[model samples]
Target: MIPAGFEYHRPADLASAVGLLQEHGEEARVVAGGHSLIPMMKLRMAELGHLVDLQAIGELKGIEIADGTAILGAMTTQHELIEHADLATAIPLLREAALQIADPQVRYLGTVGGNVANGDPGNDMPGLMQCLGARFELYGPAGTRQVAARDFYESAYFTARADDEILTKVTIPVPAAGTGYAYAKQKRKIGDYATAAAAVLVGTASASVAMTNLSDTPVWSEEAGMALANGDIEGCVAAMLAAIDPQEDMRGPIAFKKHVAAVILRRAIDSALSRRA
Candidate 1:
């Protein structure tokens, strides 16, 4: 289906981009890889007066690792994540998870910013970002503000980012030496969204666990991570099971999703622990 006609804006920098959004208000929407929003627009679910494309903004594209932190530009593609040698070394879990998102063709076009900013439950990056304790940087007319990934999502298809703001980067603290990480996902096919997915990180004295597609929002279980840090796998699993609220879908019944989440999370925990030094 053809989308309703809309004016297109290609801003060369972040400030101009923000200005366009401010001028257009809810009638304007920024697009990165055009994966999510474009489809909605085509279906007329999103009727926009202006479509602000971020592809021209150099300020929103790059990968930088410095001072025990990794800064990923919002426009960075999944293929870029998989291909960067230094990024892969600094955050192996990122590459591991990126590989699981859609297929190669989609990865080449899908942007990390789009994946996390949209608050889609099925997207893989949000849960992984929560497990990594990443921070999202938003640029707006009010200037810049940072939001914790775990605090960003309010519900499915909803996030803390105001319509006037554009997500510009993701900042992640580099895991300490010997921190082990794993992303376990279960899906019917290569391009299918996860029926259930788990991201786990086990450090010398810290642990983090988060799940995807089992709830309206990504489930980041602090209790479950604490249980793992204390070496109680069953406790971790039980806590995670208690946290997720999966609804019945074409995937399966609620009970089946819970069971799959449990099994997948356990596999992730075991895999992460084994990789630890």
Candidate 2:
């Protein structure tokens, strides 16, 4: 289906993109990879007067690691994350999770910013970002501010980012030495969204656990992480289950999804613990 006609603007920089968004207001939508928005537009679910494309903004594309932190530009593709030698060394869990997102072809086109900014519970990055305790950088007419990944999502398709703000980068503190991480996802087939998934990061000083496709937004269970750290797997699982509000879907019934979430999360936790240095 063809999308409704809309004016397209490719801004050369972040300020211009934010200005376009401000000019168009709620009538404009910023598109990165177009993986999520284009389909909605085609379905007439999203009608916009202006489509501000950020692809031309050179500042919104790259990866940088410094001062024990990694800054990933919003346009960084999954394939780029997988191919980045230093990034993989610094955070192998990112590569592990990126590999599980869609397929090779989609990975080449799907932007990490698109994956996390939209508050789509099924997208892999949000949960992983929560587990990593990442921060999102937003640029707008008001200048810049940061939002913690844990506080970014308010609901499905809703995030802390204002319509006039563009998410420009994601900043994550590098996992400390001896940190271990794993992303476990269960799906019916390749390219399918996870029926249930978990991302876990266990370090010498702290741990984080987050779940995907378990609620309207990604579920970050700090309680569960602490339980796991205290050596109570069952308690951790119970905490995780208590944190999510899974709904019935084509993937399976609510009970089945809960079961899958439990099994996958347990496996991810165990795997991460084993890999801990």
Candidate 3:
């Protein structure tokens, strides 16, 4: 299926892109990587009169690590995340999660910002970012502001990002040394969305547990993490199950999803615990 006709603007700078979005207002949609939006457009689920392409904005493309934090440009591709030596060293969980997102081809083109900012529960990054306690940087006509990953998603295809705002960066505080992390996903096959997935990080100071494809938004289970810290895997899994109400879909029935969620959560927790330094 072909997307609807639309005026396209490829802006070389963030200001120009934001200006285009500001001028076009609700009729405009900013596109990065096009992995998510293009499909929606082709299906006519999304129709935009003005498409603001962020690809040409060089400022929105790079990885920087400083002062125990890693800041990734919104346009950084999944492949880039998976391949970066510094990022792989700083946050192995991110690379592990990126490797599970679709196939190599899709990873090559799918930007991290597109995956998380769209509020797609099935996308791997959102849940992982939540587990890592990442923050999103949004730029708009008003100015720049930050939102925590845990607070970003409002619903499917809805987020804290305002209509005229563009997600420009993701700021992740590096997991403490000796932290244990795991991302466990149950999917039908390569390139398929997770039936149920879990991302767990256990550090000396804190722990976070997040689930994917289990609800309208990524489910962050603080209680589950606390339970795991108390050395009760079953209690942690139970807490996680109680936190989400997964919808029935091609993945499975409600009961099946719950069971899968339980299994994956258990596996992720156990794996992370074993790796804890």
Candidate 4:
């Protein structure tokens, strides 16, 4: 199927992009890397009168790290996440996870913002951001507001972003020195979405755990994380098992998914534990 015909826009600034959305209303959709939206449009799952392209906006593309913080522009590609030496050093979990998100071609064109903003549970970034305790910055006619990554998703393919707002960047507080991080994803093959994936970060006295494709939204169990911090591995896994609600699909039965989620969470926790100094 072909996407319904729509006018294309290239906005060089955030204000211009916002203005386009205000002018066109809900019929306008923003395009970043086009890896996700284009497919939806072709399937006619999404139809719009205006397609606002953010690629021309310099403010929406870049990576900056300083003063114990990292800022990634919405248009930054997955490949950029994997390639930036500074970012790789500051947040190695990002690079590790980005490497597993589809193959090279998709990663080259997939933007971090699109992956997270679209509220796709299968994408790797949302869960990882939750584990990292990152925040997303939104821009619109009213100006900018920030939402914690852990609180962003409302359900599958849905998020806190409003119709008139654009996600401009992601802000992450740099993890304390020597914090351990691991991203573990299991799939049938390369480029396939994770059947169950876990992101874990262990600090000296704290921990964070989040899972992808285990529920309608990313699962970040503060219960699981607290249990891990206290060194009760079983308790942590148990809490996460209780928190997730995976449905039966091509991946496997519900029982099998729960088992896989348990295994993956443990593996991620162990990997992170070993890396923690």
True-structure Cα RMSD, model 3: 1.0
Lowest summed-lDDT stretch of 10 residues in model 4?
31-40
The collision pairs in model 3 are none
Q: In candidate 4, residue 244 scores what lDDT?
A: 96
> Can you tell me which runs of candidate 2 are displaced by over 4 Å?
none
TM-score of each candidate?
0.98, 0.98, 0.98, 0.98
Q: What is candidate 2's lDDT per residue for 1-277, written digit by digit as tens? A: 8899999998898888888887878899999899999999999999999999988898999999999999999999999999999999999999999999999989999999999999898999999999999999998899999999999999998999998888989999999988889999999999999999999988776789999999999999989999887778899899999999999989989999999999999999989999999
Give per-model CA RMSD: 0.8, 0.8, 1.0, 0.9
Candidate 1's error at 121, in angstroms?
1.0
Task: Indicate which candidate wins on lDDT.
Answer: 1
- Least lDDT summed over 10 consecutive residues: which range in candidate 1? 18-27
lDDT of 1 by residue, 180-262 (tens): 89999999988999999999999988899999999999999999999999999999999999999999999999999999999
lDDT of 4 by residue, 124-204 (tens): 999999999999999999999999999999999889999899999999988988999999989999989999999999898
Ranking, lDDT, top scorer first: 1, 4, 2, 3
lDDT of each: 0.95, 0.93, 0.92, 0.94
The whole-model C-alpha lDDT of candidate 4 against the native structure comes to 0.94
